[model samples]
Target chain A: MMKGNTRGTEAADGKGSGPGRFLIRARADTNIQLGIICILIIILMTALQPRMFLSSYNFESMAFFMPELVLLSIAMMIAMLTGGIDLSIVGVANLAGIAAGTLFGFLAGEAGVGGLGTGAVILGVGVGLIVGVLAGLVNGLLISGLKITPILATLGTGQVFIGLCVVLTGGPAIVGFPSGWTWIGNGKIASIPVPFLLFVVLCVALALLLERTSFGLRLKLIGTNPKAAVFAGIRKGRMILWSYMLTGALAAMAGILLSARVNAAKSDYGSSYLLQAVLIAVLAGTNPAGGRGNVLGVALAVAALTLLATGLQMMRVSNHLIDFVWGAFLIAVIALNSLSARKGL
Target chain B: MRVLRNSNVVIALILVAAMVVIGLINPAFWQLSNIFSLLKANVVIGLMALGVLLIMISGGIDVSFTAFAIAAMYLVVRTMVAIDYDGVILPFIFATAIGGLLGLMNAGIIHKFHMIPLIVTLGTASLVRGLVLGGVGTSNVNIDEMPPSLIELGRANIVTLERANGTTFGLTAMILVYAALAILIHLVLTRTMIGRSVYAYGADPEAARRVGFKTGRTMIFVYCTAGALAGFAGLLHSSMSWLANPRGFVGLELDVIAAVVLGGCSIFGGRGSVIGTVLGVFILVMIQNSLILMGIDMTWQRVVVGGVLISAVAITALRDRRSPA
Candidate 1:
């Protein structure tokens, strides 16, 4: 908002990027720091209990978790990069999964639809994905078009979406999904989990879209300086809408897979994912301030979190303990990030 | 016409209309005893809303408030019962102190470590909740041994007004607490230097810093105040219910947040008042009460609340569109 741009002027005057450049480098250092921490954690786990930490079962569990956790983080990353937070991701996923489950139930019923057929299930999942995108659209429209703060906008819509899911299901779980649908959740390709593969593929596609696309540039510019971007002929409102929608769609994808894996959909689906997805985003070094971060970091953060949870489970820790540990980790990261941001990093 | 469109005036009108409608529909709802009972039930939440109002005005949030309160309640109840401390004031003071300490921890983490408030609060929320649950074990704290005097204020109205229809309404400590807090917070916001600093900080922390505000220290104070209020609310909750459930205030942060937002507080962190928050809570509670009178089921209650929450935000969003970011 200031007329004089210190960072831009320094760069333009050939002052070797100045303090702002150093700040960017420092941020990159933080990423490397997080990476090292992850490796060290893995090493410590191995040294403490080699037999258990390196077991095939642990790896298998991690593989199974890769899809939902990674995808959720990616969704959050997209929103974060756009200088907005999608508090509704978990709600959207829950609603989408419920939609799929409801559709499966309807198709299986005698409403003139085939029972448990591949075609019916596929159609149901497709509709579920659309529901997710629609949820995002609502969030986007309310936030960008109507100028609502992202937090309040999503909070409101999230409640509505969650309530809708409850109303649709009457607060029950929908089970008896088709066997073929489980493949999306559990099948393997070359001994690698299908979901994990999808996770990797989504990361690559998103990374490319983010790093090498005009859309990505626009988003970064908007995030860094919305007013400047607007002055530079960028459509800030439209981009925000698009990003929220993308986040919604990605969360929906995760929801669809979750429904398939669990073989059911419940009204309260994906409630636990909120804290986890947020942690993944923050840990991955995706600045909630936006215009920074990449998918690779987010992917690793997801791995680290999932590992932490799995390790705790392997150590036979109680669910309550696991929750506490996760919370402590989140606070630690947030505090660390905030300090770093203050240091002009 | 424009004056009539003022949200506060409109809300006041709505509140008055709601009371009249409820009174007409069910005179029983207007009974002094029942009215006080409802007011008591709302007091704890109303107090928490006041705390939240401060945090919201200061441009930070503590989702962990509920968790902190739960932990405090556990400590207070367990200590009171275990130590055979008969006096209510001492335990309440200790609980409030513990709650304040937790708030200080949250502020310390954010101010000292430089982390996002939401993430820090969320993590702390989970951590506190987990610890409380783990400490309590599978069995809920038995309040059968609770002090009767403390329990009575939560359960029975102190002042009753009887009607010819054999129904009565009464004033309770809960209402007194609410009214007192409302006045206190309003005065604090309007009359105190710290309160002005809160607004200035929220309005523009960068500017506040330039103007020589004690950003870190003030945040600690604000959060601690919020924490203390939450603790007091938790105590009241336990006293009223005569039990401290580990799952108390589950998803209550959302309700508080919704109330604040609906009361026209900007989630962006500046420009809200305790009066607005109280009104927000009142509107929400009134809606719930009205729905019950209309024979609306609990299942539909969620839908109605959700709709109101979204609509409020949407309305705010529309207003925000007219202003430059």
Candidate 2:
């Protein structure tokens, strides 16, 4: 079965080897579709609320809010690339945030925002990164070593992580971080939001990692056909482990930004983001079966979804209605993708 | 000898060990009243687990059942309240029908699109939840507005025992209903042609198709059955709690799935039994009850449940590895 898929991908890849190669690659069609959808969304929003939709304030708010979604979608894309998923991203993000928040509280003392200093910020951020990566490593080991299915393994770990967070914070939000910590979340550099900039930098880095590196090639090959990958002498288990760990670290980074933006860390913060992240990754054209995804596609999807959400809010739509739209959109996209594939598109 | 080799036997042994340990820690755990209470509290989960078991056996999964249940039950209760109706049977019938229709929708989409069941169900889960939460407008429906007959049914107890202390325990009608459903499901799965088709499909879809089994119809039957059961569980849940809250069953899918998996129902599909699911439900409820009795923090319950699920999966995988194909 896997050998059949290898031949199919190879044949498809060969067909695209021509003069317009750079512009007409295998995924370019989906990228163009996404671009058109994004533009249509912008036009629709502008038509509905001409002033606010096109305003600088709205853009700034989107920039501020979109970083978390972008980072998470990227993390999700990496996992999906391995023909697996990391459902524990939300839990890991919140756990990492809570861990850093606790460290911040201890180092900065209970003197509120006044006692926070540079040392506290550095230490807290460092702790968050380590904890996040370690959590991902555990998920990797479960999937790769124990041979557990990715979905169930991460589902269990997600609950465990959230439970630990709840125990640590006793089911309340941890607040009162030093003012300096907000720099990562809310700060601006040359009028570009720091979080947004961080998102862009990560996107570029990941795009490089996924497209230009040998590791990236091997990861995609494994996803395309695990049996063929094994025959080619690739360490499938090790690749899966690293993929999950990378996702974990990225989730933690998003957590730090989230905590900084909200100025609090809670076990339940961003509980809704779990489903939304999956939606974005899928909408970005990351095949849930794995082996085909691009960072640029995910970034565009984030922008499109953020616009839709912001536009709906502006139109006085209830949050529940927005959720309904997202769910509908996901179904429509998947159905359309399947239909198009049947047409040999 | 063959029974001894079954994974369900190992699970049954584990359940016995857990019960013995809990009983040793607190003698009250062995009391008739406490056992009844445990069964009563877990009746809803057991019913849902049975439904999940069927779908899993057929190489499909429906995480959206909880959402379907909540929506069906809420709509039924609200309609009844609006019309000032006071019957017990009609509301249950309506809810179950609604649940089955929702399940049919899922089956239709999955069959038509040939999409992955897990992803499709995940999307539908969110879609259903969103529709209920948005369309219902009301967050909760009070029990006082429900039919007096249903409320009475909820309060009816068959065997009440008052302890020496200021506590009482009793068996409820809900437990009886759960037992009946479990037996019915067991019979259907083991003794019916449709059940055999479901198993064949799960074990190997291509082979089942080649054998001329109507895969689409089987999927529809399996999912609709699961949905109808979920609706029944929803009614039981609201009856017990005396309220119908749309958000009440939001995250309970994890528990249902966990229980089914723990019962030796392979997530890979085509390998499970109804009796095993019952044992899984009992073991989980017992663990939760034992933890409460030991005065442990409730937050730790999630950790323990999650840890047990992973460990169980690992052990099963290891056993499969050691056994020759």
Candidate 3:
């Protein structure tokens, strides 16, 4: 508590001094620790399995693994910044992917507009956004109109969304994604992967949304103190709802990209992202209970996860064991976040 | 007058009506065979719900209940199989003990660090599941290789009844376990001083402390008991399915939670009943079974559960506003 207050005081003065420097250092320590661990893992892997870790093929493999989660982490980062969480992001993404795939293959194909052309692509993108917006609207209404807790509301939505994905896909994978679609997932712009570029654009846009705009400022305040925000004439309900909707849209976009990348949209495609996305948010120092965290923190955390996963694969860790590792990392970071939050660090 | 005033009683009546309607639509549903089948599938989830009720009543949530159970089951089966432990009871004891330890760890961490229960449990859940998967290697228990004693415990039945359709229906031993647990929990929550203390802590920790209740200790006990129940549930899951899949209970914790909430337990802690939660579990399971029987797409199952959960919470919130405590 004392440390927390001291940090608060320093921020108030718009300056740093005394233990404030140490506090800032400790906060930055989150990023440093992640970077160091990531580097250490990569180094260890390179030494232990130089043939695999140093190969360009492995680098390309890492690229394939990074996009969906990176996109999810960013979506979750948006909601985390506003002091809310979008647990339904993975489910929403999966559903959106299914929606895009089904439209391209079944509905559009039946309508004779499914030829590998611009029209089918536009239809797919439109379907993704629509599904995303609808999913977000459900979240918004449940939290605002129904007054359900975000956790419970999203848990239900997650179930519903996944179930819908299953029903739409008939519990099978939508194979034969258009070559154009795969290109988006496997493509590059200016020698940079499209997904990576998308990540950059999303981070910049979200960072601006959170740090620069008055709405963003209001949201942070609302997250910090909803009652105070309401007293300050901010529409707390509307803002919270907006945050959830925005998260849904981002999740949908991620889903569309995931479908393009995987070359097949499966019902359970986004299930794995559920743990990783939330872990990224918390690892970025975002509080699960709302209020406090940032885009840079989330981005770094995503990079760490991508690197870690890649390193694990290079080490020839079994996929099942890798899942175990993922779960452990999530728990470790969350526990640390909780401890830090409680101790006012 | 009290009966009319009791929300549980009202909800129970509604459940009965729903059940009767379902039975009317499908007479086979009322057959002893169908009832037993439903009971078999739901017993584990029901037990888990009881555990969750304790946590919720104590002003906390245990998202890790399913994960804890999964880990406990994995450890118990793996250790037993490896050591060639000869008794059915040993496996259960081993599983429940592991669960209890995990629960205690959760209670200890939450109380000591003053952390949010949800986040802590969320992390622990993942950690526990990871330990299981990593240690056991994603494999299913080959129950066919199990000793006769263990199989007997898993498949044993009592209370067989001859139906008009000339089919005999028998209740599995698992139902008896669930019933015994329900009775024990109901008694403990209502008849014991510790039980009252749990309610007090949940309703208002500050006030309970002012009245000399050891709120922290009570919380730890609640969590421990929750863990034990979850372990038992996990064992039941393995027993009924005859396989302990490493994937663990996916979304089962949420269903347990939904059951607890539907049982009229407040999410805000301090108020819940084992009986209410048990009834809630049956209601939820019945809804799921009924929907499947009606040929309603399984996808809509989640939508309904979500809708019901939201509605239940909304109703509770509204009731609280009308009669603030």
Candidate 4:
């Protein structure tokens, strides 16, 4: 708790801190330890499968695929900061994409590929973002206004949203997103993939929101202790509602990129990403009970997981085994962290 | 003030109302055939729900029971197929044993690390599932390879009804198995000393520890019992279906948890009952099974279920808040 507060102050005045203090902070942070692990994984994978892992083609694909998971992970992190989880994020994403994709079907009819103008794409995306925000708003209402538990409420909403995805498309992929729309997922700014650039820009923007804003600080206080936050007059319900909406918007952004990358949206697309995002968020040291997490930590966790997944695939390890490895990794991290905490005592 | 009125009564009324509504929508839904099938479907999910109810009563939440169920089911099926064993009793026992051991692992981690039960179980669930698929191989055992005796047991029923055209439906004897187990659980939770200890522990873990209850033992027993139930359900599901897929029972934890909560088992723990839970399971089973009878498209089934879950909890939560029970 003391360390959390110190870091709160550190981040608040982080602009004044020199590189020396930064190094100390890095050493003090578990996320930086995770960063070292990420480095180790990259080095090990490159050594083991230089031909596959080191290729520009592999890197390019990674750039495209990694952003969706990264975005999802951060979305999850924000919700966790409020001591709640949005199990509906994956559902929200698919629903948002389906909104955009289905709009394309309506506007362009049978000729949706390159037939639509850039304006049509923007309009469709706008509808998708609205869908995402609205989904988040409902989750916020259920959790805050109706007083339902976050996990259960979101789980139910998730089911409803995923069901709506199937109802919308009727059990098939909605293909034919316009070329310009796909560019958000596929295009490059300089040599970097557009998705990755978007991911970086959003992460920075979110970091600022969390670090510099009253909303972020209040969320942290609520996460740390809800009663104390209430005592301090934090208007907990409004904060929770907004937090969920933000989570929804982030989920929608990830969904839009995902469908664009694949050029289609389906009900079951990225079905595993929900739990995987949970795993990633917890691995980033976001307290599951709420009150603590950061963008940098999430970025590192996403990097580590993406690399590990790619490396395992390259080595011909089945996806199931990789999941097993991730589960094991989570427990091991918990155990090791506890052990280290004991040693400090 | 009596904290809140017994939610058991409230939920029971809801369950009956749902049944009546469905029956009104489709007269055929009242047929013994549909009811029998519903009971059969309820067995797998119901067993798992009963086990989770125990965990929740201990102030712990688990999302790993589905993993345990699948693991036990897949491992037992794989072994039986390999060894050419045919007896139904042995597979159930083995499945129960396997599930108990996996549950022990979950208890061990949560106990040793003092971590959140949900996250720990989630990890173990993923890990165990991975181990089964990766180490044991991810192949579905075809019906032809299934043990003859096992299939016979799964197909066994107390009574069979012949349709006008000659098709038949049986009230799967599995309902008896479910009833027998549920009765045992109900007795344990009500008539036994350990059961009272579970309630005390859930009501306040710290106080329970200070009051001299064996906290660790209660946790172990609760999780082990739940895990064993999951394993039993998993194998029965396979046998009843006459096939075992390595990827079966995905996302079932949420459903069972939903049922448990609907039954009035408080998510915060120390409050639940078997009768209420059974009724809750029946409600879910009816909703899912009667989707066909209601003329609802299959794709919309989940939406209906999700909608019901959210509203039910929301209503109950609002009521609870007024009294702060």
Clashing pairs in 4: none
Q: What is the TM-score of chain B alone in each candidate?
A: 0.90, 0.95, 0.94, 0.96
lDDT of 1 at A89: 83
Model 4 lDDT per residue over B1-325, tens place: 2433778777777888889999999999988888888888899989999999899777777888888888999989888888988788889999999999999988888777666676688789889999999888888987898888778888998999899889987899998999999999999999997897888777777678899998888888899999999999999998889998888888788788888878887655677889988988988988888988999999897788888778767875676567644
TM-score of each: 0.91, 0.95, 0.91, 0.94
Q: For model 2, which pairs clash?
A: none
- Higher-scoring candidate on DockQ, 2 or 3: 2
lDDT tens readout by residue for model 2, A1-345: 221123223423232222335323647877888899999999999999999999999999999989898998899999988778888999999998999888877765657665778888888888988988999999999889987777778888998898899888988899867777888898999999999999889889999999999999888778766877899999999999999999999999999999999889999899878878888888887777667788999989999999999999999988877777887887888788667665753
Point out the worst 10-residue segment of candidate 2 chain B by lDDT: B316-325
lDDT tens string, model 1, B4-64?
5466765677678878888787777775565555666578888888888898888777788
**Full ranking by lDDT:** 4, 2, 1, 3
lDDT of 3 by residue, A1-345 (tens): 111122122222221222545534654777787778778877877888888777987776666657678778877876755555677898899888888888777755654433577667877888898999899988888777666656667777877787788778778888867666777788888777887777778878888987689977787666555666789999877887888888888899888888888777886776768777877877876654444556777777887777777777666776667766776676566456545545553
Candidate number with the higher DockQ (1 or 4):
4
Residue pairs in collision within model 3: A83-A291, B203-B270
lDDT, each prediction: 0.76, 0.83, 0.75, 0.84
Model 1: residues with Cα > 4 Å off, grouped in runs: A1-35, A110-115, A338-345, B17-34, B135-138, B145-149, B161-170, B317-325
Best by DockQ: 4
lDDT of 3 by residue, B93-212 (tens): 878888899999889877665555665677677677777777666778778755455666777888778878797777888888899988998999999989999888777766788999
Q: lDDT at B58 for candidate 1?
A: 82
Order of quality (DockQ): 4, 1, 2, 3
TM-score of chain A of 2: 0.93
